[model samples]
Target: MSNSRSTKLHVAMFPWFAFGHITPYLHLSNNLAERGHRVSFLLPKGAQAKITPGAETASDVPFPLHGHLCIAFDQTQDQVQTILSSLKPDFIFFDFSLWMPALAHQIGSKAIYYSVITPVAQALKVPTKQKLEDMTLEDFMQLPPGYPSPSVRIKSKAFEIAQLKVVAEDLGTGMSIYVRITSSMIWSDAMAFRTYHEVEGPYCDYLRKHYAKPVLLTGPVLPETLATKLDEKWTNWLCNFKQGTVVYCAFGSQNKLQKDQFQELLLGFKLCRQPFLVALSTPDGCATIEEAFPEGFQESVKGRGWVYGGWVPQTLILEHPSIGCSVTHCGYGSMWESLFSDCQIVCVPYLGDQILGARLMVEELKVAVEVEREDNGWISKESLSKAIISVMDKDSEIAGLVKYNHAKLKEELTSEGMQERYLDTFIQNLQGLLD
Candidate 1:
């Protein structure tokens, strides 16, 4: 063990461009610095503002680690060494595009990557044999004329055993070079995750026994993130809404939908007659949304909902009592936020990890429901309306059950027993480095 008093780690954090990645990496950096470690966050220039004002930032922020610490380049094997040669930090914690084996061989640095969501949920997505890489144009174009995609043959058959083997092997080989990873199981790491062990315990157990990485979760890092005065203004609008009264809807940044799907969601929300706040980008192939809306649709819902063209304060809004339920793209960050809040989730996950998060929310968590997705990837009006009503016009049974479950999870969140145990573990890990 490095002497607690003798060694001080100069740690670097590299997180992806998105807010999800940026926010937590900042939090971890902050935590390490508070603990007396030297820390610098490596990020694209544009995101400098994402770091809070008055927060410590290294003046020699840009330094050659392996070569020159360049973050924007498509993460490749060569860059890792370039970073190591320069900064030579005791450790580097990365959140995305981590090709571990290459990094370790390039520089014998302890490189750790944080999985912000459940890695077990991720391992679940490892392709089963029988999965095809891409659907032919024919399969892609077909609308799920009648049923959900998972119920259909295409998605379920994805991931053959052979494919799973290859993906697993690829990951395992990376561990051979590095010390694997030391953290995951996001919620258990965070006191904020109110999950029942009875349901997800098997998953948590699988991770602990097999993966061997300590499940290190800090409490939900509040994405109460901001950039400038513009963000402060936007937050003001959110502040105006009543707690648990507003429907907070946002499809995460990458999952841009085509015009039809966007219109369908608008029309469905209009049909539901509830107050909705939506954060959106223009749908695919359309520069503006004016052409997509149904006639009189915009005027009709004008006073009832707010549709902002860009980003929303996702984490802060979700915690608001006025924002009762979330309509999400099922992004990993959003999923954990909703789970941490123990709020209602309405999933319309667009792709990749979103779909994986969707399956867990629908099949396991039982706190949310899925919005229908046609093969064409359009979420139709009927499906949207049906889902809206399912959560909005709630009966005594569901509301009661949701409350009960939320309460149980809330207990876990506030439980001194759990909090002490987790914090003790965190402190111990740091202490171990010293011992």
Candidate 2:
């Protein structure tokens, strides 16, 4: 490892083909760039347009077609290699591209498997020698050996376990998702996650011992500043409501719900009887959010609820004083955003990693409440309403406790020099890798 303090390394960013993945890579790139490190970011043209323009990500693609996207992403390997050859960067930071290590080696660059997902999720689903095709629900139900937290175990829920199995299956790619992620870690020069040790230290340490490799932390990778403002229409609407009175619900660009569930979620907001805004993709079989609305839903919630099918300024909205509570799908990026905001959090997770993230929030951190799901993984309007009301109600004890805890933790995380210190140490470690 190099001890030189003045070395500034050129790093390449090639994340998986999802905005959830790409956006974090960009945040890290911005951080590196601010430190005078050269960064070359590579992504598909469609992805590039979405970040710059307002187009949604490939995550909005239907679930059945995700495999095709993976196949296309893999086909870019040769193109990526050619680009790397020309750049000759000192380090390549990537995730989901299991083939990146060899390509980095070809160019004499160190490959860093920089995971945007939580280490708790990775620790629970640690890679094993067993074939993914043969792994059963029982296999996923059992916590991996030496898992850091007993609280983060997979529930006996069939839907959750089934989702895990699906993740382990080949999604049009030749390799299973599990193999793609684990193999990347196994072959990379080092492993890094977009998390701080204060929150996820045990899990990070466990992964280090399990993989026998350097594990680095990037301290949440939040942007230091924002360049944009909330849309005028939203600002106008939210101003009519008092501070901490409106509930905001968004399940991210991905995760289009079933038509039935879509209406149920709307009904949940109506039951809460709070002024609210919901941003979501059109549900399956529905062309617009209005088409999927439950009968009388519009007339009932009339002026109190607004549902939009396009993207809204989420980070800005969360920062709005009127947004008292947020109902999220617990995606990693959203999790960080919610943690940094003052809003009370209610989680309705739809994926494996999201489920684990929700557990980390609700169970481990005690900073949020999770909407209960049925045995088949269906979330009910009543459950959603209950979760939101529990947090939004001023008189509720649980609400006060979670709010206090969340505020304390948020202060610690965003304290002056916290993110800067993490980035500085991370850069020092990168220089060491070149030795």
Best by TM-score: 2
Candidate 2 Cα errors over 4 Å, as ranges: 1-5, 52-57, 126-147, 150-156, 225-227
Model 1 poorest ten-residue lDDT run = 58-67
lDDT of 2: 0.84
Best by lDDT: 2
Give the Å error, residue 175, model 2: 2.3
> What is the per-residue lDDT of model 1 for residues 1-435, given as tens digits with 9 covering 90 to 100?
434334466766665445555666776566556657798667655557644322122212211121122233334436656766688765566644445424643564555556555443333432224334443212221222331222212233232222223223333233310122222222122111212343345555445554454544445443334442335565566567666667778876555666766887888888777778888876767767576666788789875677767666677667666677788887766776777675667887654446656766676556677876555455677888777667765574665565467557666655655533443345455445334
lDDT for each residue of candidate 2 in 279-368, tens digit (9 for 90 to 100) = 989888987778998998888887788999988878899999999998999999899999999999999888878887888899888999
- List the pairs of residues colliding in candidate 2: none
Over 4 Å off, model 1 = 1-8, 49-80, 95-102, 105-108, 125-201, 212-215, 223-243, 289-291, 375-377, 416-424, 430-435
